[model samples]
Target chain A: MHHRLDALLPLAGAILFVMLWWLLALSGVIDPVLMPAPQDAAVALWKGFADGTLTHDFWQTVWRTVLSFVIATAIGVPLGIALGSSSRVYAAVEFVIDFFRSTPASALFPMFLVIFGVGEKTKIAVAAFGAALVILFNVAYGVMNAKKTRQAAAHVMGAGRLRIMVDVTLWESLPQTFVGMRSGISLALVIVIVAEMFIGSTDGLGQRVINAQMVFDMPLMYAAIFAAGALGYGLNLLFLVIERRFVHWGGK
Target chain B: MTSHSPGSPHITIRGLTKAFAGVPLYDGFNLDFARGRITSIFGPNGCGKSTLINMIAGLMPMDGGQVLFDGKTLRETVIGYVFQNYRDALFPWKRAIDNIAYPLVRAGMDRAAIDARVDELVTSFDIGFDLKRYPYELSGGQQQLVSIMRALAPRPEVLFLDEPFSALDYEMTLSMRDKLQEVFHATGVTMILVSHDLEEAVYLADHVLMLTRRPTRIAEVIDFGAPRPRTSATLSEPGFVRAKAHALDVFQREVRRAP
Candidate 1:
């Protein structure tokens, strides 16, 4: 009973907040154009669904985010592993990674637009760059903290460097890698949406929100904002499930 | 069985020296393990027993020395080592059976053969209660036994054990000793054990190597010519008692001399 209640607490809080917003709107304390009532937001979301506008934008956002995440994992995981395993390489690249991390992803948006132009490619580049920075450091930290004795034991057991990585280093760092990917997913979602919103785009959820705001369609804009939040929460839960399945030892 | 193979010693160490932070641990250390015999190293705490074993295991680099195995450099030889801390010895994430099969995975054995060997070892070691259980779930004694089986599964020429039974209770330790004797008798592999417990050392070793304190060097090498199939009766033998007394004296002297 207690566990179920704990799980439901967040949903309960969200419902209460929506109800409070409805009451505030009903009292005429805020104008409809400025603060849409909960029902108006829901109606606007439902109308978008019927017209296929919401579905198209949602799929566009999903594809771009997924592609960006894959690109980040492909480049970031290997670079992180290499830097982590070799002391000389890590020392050489440490300053560069730190600088990239400190520079905001938004600052690179204009550069990406100039180089790649305002398209899916530009948005992906921005998202991948931002997401890769987060995962690379995590991978380095995981490799540095790997057990020496385990590696030595594998060596004595006739494992070469590659085998040592498969049996020991990579396997041991797997949990940390999963954690890094989890965090990267969240960061990528944030950057991908922002990239889609600011950089020229016409079909993504971010573009829809910007379009609504420009036309003074407050209900549509609020609905899109809520949709983005929902999508982020859903992706986080999905990543958590993946983490649990792969690393059963690390309990939820 | 009385003499080593008609060649150089199975393992030969000469002028082995190791230092940490300007403090010398082993200086001009020399030792050898004869082929097909169990040798135990006994010493007072901080006498570099672990340091010597770690060097032999190739876990650490020696300050100045050479280690020869069967007249070959250590880089050219195969060795198996069992750490005293079972917590460190076994990977907590792996199941007991997989842990036992680790050596085979490293050796590039076929999956079927590895599975067969792992099954045999699991049965031989009686690790059935929780073959699928992780190391952290098992007791200290259970984990230690699993560690020993993991080290032995590879069937290395020379096995290095660093006080693997120290953490066990009295009864568990005795049973583990019995299991070890059974394994050694069955395999006939050379063994070297490093320990501080005199009785435990004499109980298991054919020859006990004693060491002095830091800047450590061998104090003495006591040979127990007791016949094989060692048991409780071996401990009561006159020579065993005398050797234990002598080991105690060296241990006490080292204790007094160490800062």
Candidate 2:
């Protein structure tokens, strides 16, 4: 009985939250323009889906996020492994990595815009840069912290440098690499949306939000925001599932 | 059985010197390990027994002198080292069978050959546990068994076990010792064991090399001429008792001499 109730708790809380919002809207204490009714937002969500505007914009944002994320992983994972494997390489580049990792990724947007000319490239570059740093940091630490005994065991078995890297270091760093990928993808989405909102974008969920707010379409604006949040949650859930399946021995 | 005279040294160590954090552990140390025999190294806590075996196994570097193998350089000779921490020694991600087959896989053995070798070993050891489980899923003794199986997979010329049974419980330790003896007899591999337990050293080894503390040296090398397939009864045999006592005497004298 308790298990069943526990499973329903999240749904119950969501229902209560929506009911409170509806009651507050009915009370007329707050402006409807600022806090639209839940039903009105639902209606706007349906209209956008029926007209296909929401679907197109959603796919556009997803494509940009995925493209930048792939680029980040491609550059960051190998670089991280190299730095982690060699203390000399890590020492040479440590200061630079720390400096860029600490600096807010948004601060680099002006430079990216100048180089890429405010096109899709600039938007993708900013997101990829941020995501790469996160992945690199995690991968390097993972390689550095691999258990010493395992390495020694492999060495005694006559494993050469390349074999050790592929069989031991790569598998050892996998759990942490997954962690980096999850956070990297999330940051990629955030940067893409921010770019769409502030920088010039022809069509995206963020563009729809900006356009709706300018025309005082509060319900449409709220619906677009909800869709973006749903996308993030869904992406995070996808990563969690993959991590569980692949990294079953992570905690062990 | 192979002849094990002082003249027939399979591995000869000369003037080995090593220090940790500027404190000397082995200063100009020297010894010879015979082929086809189980040699146990015994010393007090913090002694350099593990260090000595690691250096010989070429797992670590020696500051001075060199190790001369009978027929090859250190790199060309196949070696196996089983660490004290079996939990960390075995790869937790791989299943027990995979761990056993890791060395063969590294040697680029074909799939059928690898499977055949692994199956042969499993049949020889006669360990009835499921080999499909991950290392972490098995008990401590089972994991260490997998580690030993992996070490033997490469058919190493010399197998260095750094206190392999130190972490196991009494029952597990007994069973693991039995398994080690069976494998040792079957393969006749040159075995070097670093041990702290006096009785265990005598029970498992054909000869025991007792050492002094830091700045370590071989205080004495006592040989046990007991029969093969040592068992619980061997622990109480007169030969075993005499060898253990001789090792204990040397160990106490050396430890007491330290300032």
TM-score of 2: 0.94
- Encode model 2's per-residue lDDT on A125-224: one tens digit a residue: 9999999999998999899888888888988887888888887888899899999999999999999888888889988888889989999999999899
TM-score of each: 0.88, 0.94
What would you estimate as the lDDT of candidate 2?
0.89
| Tens-digit lDDT string for candidate 1 (B16-59) | 88889998887787887778778898777777787788888888
Please list the residue runs of candidate 2 whose C-alpha ends up more than 4 Å from where it truly belongs after superposition. Answer: B1-8, B236-242
Worst 10 residues of 1 chain B by lDDT: B1-10
Off by over 4 Å in 1: A1-7, A250-252, B1-9, B91-94, B130-140, B166-174, B196-199, B223-245
DockQ of 2: 0.66
What tens digits encode model 2's per-residue C-alpha lDDT throughout B1-259?
Answer: 3345533677889999999999998888888898888999998777888888888988789999889778467987888888999898888789999999999998899999999999999999898799999998999998899999999998988889999999999999999999999899898888999998888898999888988777787778888879888889998888788888888888888878854
Instruction: State which docking tier applies to candidate 1.
Output: acceptable
* Candidate 2 chain B minimal-lDDT segment of 10 residues: B1-10
